[model samples]
Target: MPAARSGSTRSRPIRRWCRSISRTTRSSRIVSTRPARCARPRIPISTRSSPTTRAGGCSCARTPIIARAARPPAITAASAPRRTRTRRRRPRMADQNLIENDEPLLVAKSLSKSFGRINACRDVSFSLHPGEVLAIVGESGSGKSTLLQLLSGQLAPSAGHVSYRMRDGVARDLASLGEAERRFLFRTDWGFVHQDPAQGLRMAVSAGANVGERLMAVGWNHYGRIRDTASDWLTRVEIDTARIDDAPRTYSGGMRQRLQIARNLVTEPRLVFMDEPTGGLDVSVQARLLDLLRSLVAELNLAVVIVTHDLAVARLLSHRVMVMKGGRVIETGLTDQVLDDPREPYTQLLVSSILPP
Candidate 1:
């Protein structure tokens, strides 16, 4: 009985010692743990247009240009793009707005000219309409040429104004333009035929050269056209085409004058100023030239202003006549009425002196 009790007590003591060691180990346990740390990937906001026309990966909606980031630098939310302002467009108007209402192609308003003591022209007012021919007639030294020069923009008027047609087909007050501005008109709009044939034609050059010289003056260099135009003009003016190459030096007075006319007319100038066109030619030749000029003017719808002492030339060529004396216009009327009725004393004298040419 004593031996059995001692063995049971020893087994119980060993079980209790193992249980105590297990409890101490459980209390001393350490738990190793870390907070969650995952990487957030950086995304770029693209503003560049796509290279392909189809815009494969483009994010741009309009023509806004995107700026590149600063070199070797990190970007932040504060460094965003700014917007640009667009310009406001204005409406346009027609050139008719630039011109005064319903003015003639040329208007010489109270135009006066004085070469020192000599009063060449005074208070000369006239208007030239498109397709109309006007003749200014007077005795020698009565300022007809001077008035023509003034209207043609060759000489600036000492007083008054001249208006010439512009690109809009409206007359512009020439007094408003500087010399440089007026040159623009001379380059394109007008032509002049001088009283002297020599002044109109270059004597050294051929008749063809004389005719085609205007084309050259206006910057035309095409040889075939120049040749054809010159030849055609020669034929039109009744000059023989075989004589087209001959110089004015070789030509008679009438031929020289005809050449001069052909030279001025070939350009088909809108407004032409002629000084005594049929001055020296015989009656038959004068009639021929006048007929030719009339046909050409009608065909081309040309406007002309002629300064002449020849009443016959005025009657033949012009629709209207302005009689000037002592630097003033004495009478102005339709050509037939002025010639036949003779309102002014000077007109009567001129009509009486004509001798029924």
Candidate 2:
């Protein structure tokens, strides 16, 4: 009986232990199914993620949950607009001032330049309104280039004066502006595209730098913003953005010219001067460039003064045509009137010379 009692006592303790373990297992399963409460310190509701957390600790502490919530949304097309919209940035001056002021944007009065008894330009008078494109057409030595230089302040006119309307609705003579003001105007308000890209682009620098330099000159110091702006202009000129890091010297003739255009247009200049921009290019390249120029001019409402010997280019790009001969404007009128129905004999001969393609 004593042995049986001892065995029974031992069996009772084992059975008690087994019952306690079973109770613990069942309780744990119930607790898990009922959703374990978070043991982490309470944070702001905004910082909190979904309430569904694992047992023992909060996942927020292990992972950067707060940072993920605080992060900005991804940049999508709807959220971020294209850089081309930058053209509209000067609406206050371009739209309001242009409307309030009825005067022409640019005016030249009897502009003449003489180089040692040789007259380059004589009695050149014209006015350019906002968003107008004027084409100067003539043979090689028609003084178109000289006239352009005088209008752009690259040369001092021997006889006449050039006046430009400022954003403040005041007309000021080009000569009246100080050197610093002229430089600022050139950087901000004017763009010059040479026939030769080498004359316009810095051959040693990257294409992006060539474009960004103008922005820098105008106090753009943010590296990221400058890069984005340069990239946008390059794309507008149909240049592959992948080649932005390449130097201008590495680019082809057409690409160099396009890069030059992008460089000039990045600052969104009010006035652009082009000297045979499509000169010496392949026929296809010239056509493509002309189309691009036309679209950009129309889109930006830019005022352009372009010098070209190509009559086709003048017809395609200009609102007004100025015919030059012997350092004088032989004919001047609307592009269609001047080209389709020539009033001057010289212009008639010039038109007849172009065999239809």
Candidate 3:
């Protein structure tokens, strides 16, 4: 019985040792599987463990497997800040394009005008620079007036475009402008001086009232300030202040002309069309008025189109001149150059008329 008991004890120890060997073999196999299975597939799945990391068991290749470096706890809020930040930042970048600078002040391309059956103006092309006078000189019925009418938006063109671009980047088709828009944007920016200044003025109204009427037309109702503003321009044009409220009929022809000028000028128009601003006046008054006009135009930096049969008027008050005959411009050049050296016969004739005998 003692021998049998001793044999059982030895068998029990051997069985326990066998169980331990099996367990160790299984653990080594699990650890070795990562490199053999995972390494050769691509980037190796590693089995070298750290306190902060755990990896899936993968059999890759016969090499030492190293784990990816451990990271801190995931901060979910910080990870996605870029997506939220981009939404707020995008509009600031987009707003840079708004209120862009305007292209050009005025662009008239292949402009033409007709009166019933007559081709009054044909393919006339010119650009008016800011604060420059562009004198349009021609014989009677040569379409100077018609061109002005087309340019100033009083008459529609038979063909082509007259586009006025404002400083705010709004392009207005002068030919296509509605009545209210024209009155609001156009009439305020442009003024027309008739061949006879009387044609531009309301002779029945007082001198102050003549200018005050424009303020009224543009929705200004401050009568006290309007009258004072009218007086200021009348004084600028050298009209005596006492006659500010007097009827235009009471003033002499020269005073009436000066008052009419005040009527056109007080609005500070960007462009003014003068049919014959210096016409039908005595030399002394003409000289005075010319000086006044020159000074005002310079001070205000106004762009003007002065139409005159008198080439002298063209030379006296123009930077550039176009000599037109029979509804077509025969010659165009800088005022001094065109007048000194005429190219066409019609232009020569116009120039010849200006020389003293």
Best by lDDT: 2
| Cα lDDT, all candidates | 0.72, 0.82, 0.69
Candidate 2: lDDT of 331? 94
Give the per-residue lDDT digits (tens) of candidate 3, residues 131-234: 77989988889988888888888888888878886656577788677788887764477877775766778878788888898888888899799988988888
Tens-digit per-residue lDDT, 52-165, candidate 2: 322332333222334334434445566577675445455676577467436798999999999999999999899998889999999999899999899999999999899998
CA error at residue 148 for candidate 3, angstroms:
1.2
Residue 213 displacement (Å), model 3:
1.9
| TM-score to native of every candidate shown | 0.67, 0.73, 0.68
User: Per-residue lDDT tens digits of candidate 1, residues 122-176?
Assistant: 9988887777899999999888988988888788899999888775766578777
Off by over 4 Å in 1: 1-102, 175-184
Residue 227 displacement (Å), model 1:
1.1
Ranking by TM-score: 2, 3, 1
Scored against the true structure, residue 50 in model 2 reaches a CA lDDT of 34
Off by over 4 Å in 2: 1-101
